[model samples]
Target chain A: MTTMPSFDQWMKAVQAEMEDALLRHLPATQQIPVRLHEAMHYAVLDGGKRVRPLLVHAAGALFDADARELQRAAAAVEMIHAYSLVHDDMPCMDDDALRRGKPTVHVQYDEACALLVGDALQSQAFDVLSSGNLPPERQLAMVRLLAQASGSLGMCGGQAIDLDSVGLQLTLEELERMHQLKTGALLRVSVLLGALAGKALNDDETAALDAYAAATGLAFQVVDDVLDATADSATLGKTAGKDAADNKPTYVSILGLEQSRALAEQLCVDAHRALQPFGEKARRLRELADLIVQRKA
Target chain B: MTTMPSFDQWMKAVQAEMEDALLRHLPATQQIPVRLHEAMHYAVLDGGKRVRPLLVHAAGALFDADARELQRAAAAVEMIHAYSLVHDDMPCMDDDALRRGKPTVHVQYDEACALLVGDALQSQAFDVLSSGNLPPERQLAMVRLLAQASGSLGMCGGQAIDLDSVGLQLTLEELERMHQLKTGALLRVSVLLGALAGKALNDDETAALDAYAAATGLAFQVVDDVLDATADSATLGKTAGKDAADNKPTYVSILGLEQSRALAEQLCVDAHRALQPFGEKARRLRELADLIVQRKA
Candidate 1:
């Protein structure tokens, strides 16, 4: 706690902490309905970029949030992210056979188990979020935020839009709205949940964080679109150029690869600008914005 | 209410109130991702007996809970119930085309839409439950209650067990455990949610309600087993006698129809005895127990 850990060390620490947090929070595989619990473990553990948890921890650092509280918040958001990925990969949806360099839940287990695992994980997210040292009111607020981000008007709503937009041309405004709900909502909530774990924000602080989150959230997807178009399967970890292959609308598809890359950069600038009021307190959040835009995958 | 409306009238009134409440609480069709929202409405509205809501209202009556809070709780539980049915009817699960005499969500919409609808509706359940006149602590408690009943250790876990048990003979104890987690959990929570809306209960009161709910909850499935064996599709409003065809174990499959009927009767007696502490305040609960055990469908 004397000198700061390097950025890579800090991120690895956060990721490692979340690995333990998610494992401890998830229902034990030893529980009855062992297969389902095991699959829940399978779907959540040892997977994904852990980007959502990273944001939670970084935003939490701004206000010096309680360590255990931040861990729970980060795990809860990651669970929501994980469950969405599980459902989105179902045969009736994306039909993907792989995720995180491993067979997808529906492919590894059966589709029914995948469905149940996703449903149960979503429940587990709320269960974990509503527990712990936070005041009851805070717990209720956290639950509300998680539900609103996950519900019809948020991530699921965004996915429905994405599903319908397949092979169709969407205007930039429409695509932005879709991404805002689909991917942006959860990303933004990760920051808010992190901050909430420490203390409620005043209006100006809330507005600043929202602006930063909005910029970084969109930047994350913009980078994703760019990586999908420009990177190889080996680099990206999933299929490369799949959006264009599937004829799904994406920033790269709509804006072209060059313009999509430019948009991501612009979003990064906006995110950095939004944190000027916080100065040094916003270091992790600032670095995260850059990482989101500049990541190769 | 002053004159004490007849039980039939009271039941109708509660149903009417719930229909309106659900309509108001569910996301509107005009929302973006309109199809998903519309399907959510279709899955929840104008379907099945409002047995869970009835239990919520009945339990709320014991504590004279706020009517509006009870409505939110009732709708929340019903949404949870509705989502479970939607997912359970998918091709990967029970694969039923018909539910409550209408095409199932997956059949009416596409399977993907049904999946999203179920996921969104589950989030909506928490959204609605956590938003009302109740204190924040109460809302958090209710959310926790709903999640426990709906998550791996609850409804979904029961389903995984059911999926594994198909075509296999189950012992009576195993069958009871499955049913307890499956339908019993939600039904029991309906009563608990109702009572929770009134105010927190003392240990004795909670025990009384739990005993009553546990008995009636099991009796519900027992009667369902009996009816599935004897009732026609039209009488049941869905396919009947399909359980045996599917090789799923039920109370009547292990015990004779006569014994299942006798068990239902015994449960009804237990339910009634459990309500003795509340005397006149328990009238709706008492009637609900008889309704559950004696209903033809």
Candidate 2:
């Protein structure tokens, strides 16, 4: 039997790969506005676990895709994530003073600078995708997928719902719907983009990956909710109890701690089953899904 | 000689063409988020002169390009303009309560909604370009052009400078540099995209179009500054005299009123001369430059 790679080792390898990829793609262009580039580099290079980019790279590696090709896709996804966090922390939105244990963009810079940085980063995501060395058809598909995942029907739309529903008791279904759009959409896109970056997948394989992404995406959120409830600031790397302090709706809030944990475990199992067709090719993805649910931070 | 179209008649023609073109392209797809569509419609259909779209159409017509094929390009440019305006009006930005006498997006809905709408609109501009009937290479080129024009080096960058430089006295050169990126980038893109939408232009024609766009764009801003200083709210259709009130830098602020007016007239003449090769074929463009500098409102 093949020995399982240590989770820490795998994460470290992927993080290095992702960092190299991001740096390779984000060359300082004389034409790019200097301040804009500074802000983008500031937010993107700010330390965080390279989880989304790792998922992308791991999924691509499962199919024996080119590592360098997958790197651009990975960087693009991470850029989107960074941009979302920047905007989410704005005064008008979540009003987060801290992110990843550091002052949030708006707090670190003025609100207007933070806002423009987020806007620039968001636009840069599409810019990188469209301008990167991808075929036109693939570029078009990637743009469309990222747009759907980031726009109203995806991340931004989910944010609107979250803003509207803040401080209100939400049903389990409503919470799931919100999380699906807010987090699940981009997470699924991460996997979908990886598959697209690799060789084309048959309908069955695509469906299986979709199922896996869907389950794991929700499981990731459940774990986040659980951590938010249980973990302290140092461990979580952000304000631990802000959700509850703000009276925000969460899976744990709606389903109780035990129930939420149970749901997460169930989803992880479903995710593993979804990867069954890929056999050993998807072993890393399976482990990643489990790690997501089991994560304490 | 064909009687020159009256200004009102010309505007009505452009408005009808813009509406028809937008509707033709905006298919009723269930997949598209309804709220996004509503926001796009709200901003696009909000009354304005449609000058950007007009410039696209007129520039294409000068090359005898198919009017039908140019519609998508026209709509795409307008959408970018509209989205920029929405974001520019946010509380953290210009904080304008009204745009063209109607409540700004943030005032009409909320800051979150307005931000999302702007994001959607910006992404949708790319979507239209990518999914339109243009060749893949052409679409890719258009996407790059639009991204560069709308991105940090272009409109957004311009806005950032404007925000940062507020209340500080600016030199004429500095002011011109700001407007070049802000308004002139899109204006140049308007004409270049028109040429790209038509049969591709040779280097000479492309260079001339750039010159035309730059001169006319600067003239447009000079006239705007002049109007802000002299016009009333009723005629301007939005807050007037607010620029001087805020101590915002403008051409009239940096140069005296007479010098500013002289600069605008000189730019208009340069704009007309840039189209000399096309001559009467660009009569409408020449008329537009004159009208922009001479308009009371």
Candidate 3:
């Protein structure tokens, strides 16, 4: 077998690719409704760790997916992530002034512009995913997966539950359900979208991928909770400890800091186990599980 | 030709169908993210003119579309319309307390809930449109059309322009472009989606439908401008004279009230002429052009 780039090298390469892909799909700053286009560009470009793109590329690697298709898929998922962050940072929501180590969209632009940026970015995501020369069924499938993941029963639902749960204690079960819907659903779909971008997988393999994504999703959130508790705002690139400050429940809130760390690690191990069916071909996926839990921010 | 429902009868039946279709696709309030679901229902159900749905069904009638397919298309468009209204009424946007004779989503619930409800409903629209047993290509077409119509170049883009244009004077050309993007694009797409719900259209027929929708869309806006200036809050169901009060440009702002009414009448004639290709089968679409321009509300 050909040698693969080290995880760091692969990640850096994919990040660069995502930058180009996202730029290509976004409306230019010079476009009509110039301010809106500028804000959309600002919200999406030159920021974020791009965890979703990394996951998409890693998963795409397993199926020998075309880089072009994966680029579109990666960009679409990242746009959704960026849009969510834009809205979540709004004064009506988290009311945060910072995101990705920069002023949040609402702080940089007005709140109305920020809202339009988020809404426009979402439409752009679907447009990018379904725009190219992919098979009709595959395109439709990807669109459906994304719509469902982003819909009421998924990310937005989680946001709603989070909104209601502020200042109130949530059980461990409730917290898990919230995270599963909010963060987990999108992450899982990122993997599935990557796979669907290339060759189809069998039932056994699909389930294995689902399991890997599910475990990894939980690990990512748990790690986020731990970081929010342990890291400073500078390191976190956002308002660290904002969850606890807002009286919002999170993995760390329910499981305690040390237990959350342990749970994240355990979840990482479970993610690795879920990749057994793919053997060595799943190395990128396996590495992601580790990175998700081990990263400082 | 078979006896058809009168315009009043046809519109009433389709409005009822849209209510059922919208409810069927929405997450039940008892669902996991109960608050979000509840807000989504509150924002969408039992409100609005259902104009987009009416346009969808009217256009579908010309194609002899399946009622089921038209139902899904109509509901999806209405969901989009509802979500836009929810966002438009937020404190950051128009900050209005009333919509469709009831408290706005943000007024009834909260700003955060309104945001989530709008977002969740947008996702639900795509989900509902893509979920059924329609042909894959047609489904993909409808999706792409909706995404394009709602994206940076479409409805949201128009909103951004409107946000930018408040208290500014716009030339007649600029005003038309703004309306075309903001409200006209969605209206045009509603017609296209309805027609797409049935059999495919040739280039000539498609062009004719596009023209028909364009004229109707503008006429609808012109009528809105007139109503906003002439009607009271109780009759309009929204705050009356909002455009004038907000200093936002409208047809009435650019043209004298007399000219605006003349424009609407001329556009209605154009709409009827565009339906010449469809002959008698285009009755519903022809009837809708009149309703849009003639409605007291």
Query: Which stretches in model 2 have alpha-carbon errors above 4 Å?
Result: A1-7, A24-34, B1-11, B20-40, B63-69, B279-283
Could you tell me how far off, in angstroms, the CA of residue B161 lies in candidate 1 after the best superposition? Answer: 0.5
A89-208: candidate 3 lDDT, tens digit per residue: 999999999998999999998999999999999888988887866888778888999999998988998888888888888899888888888999999999998888877678988899
Off by over 4 Å in 1: none
lDDT per residue as tens, model 2, B1-297: 898787568767877988988766553434444555566577768478888888887787687777776788888788889888888888888888878888888888778778877876676676676676667767777777887788777888888888877889888888999999889999899888877887667889988999999999999999999999999988988889988987899998889799999999999999988999987878777877887888888
Clash-forming residue pairs, model 3: none
Pairs that collide in candidate 1 are none
Best-first order by DockQ: 1, 3, 2
Local accuracy of candidate 1 as per-residue lDDT tens digits, A72-115 = 99998899899999999999999887677788999999999999
Taking all chains together, the TM-score of candidate 3 against the true structure is: 0.98
TM-score of chain B of each: 0.98, 0.93, 0.98
Better of 1 and 2 by TM-score: 1
lDDT (Cα, tens digit) per residue for candidate 2, span A175-270: 888889899988998888777777767899889989999999999999999999999999888889988998999988889899999999999999
Candidate 1 vs candidate 2: which has greater DockQ?
Answer: 1
Q: After superposition, how far is residue B10 of candidate 1 from its true place, in Å?
A: 0.8
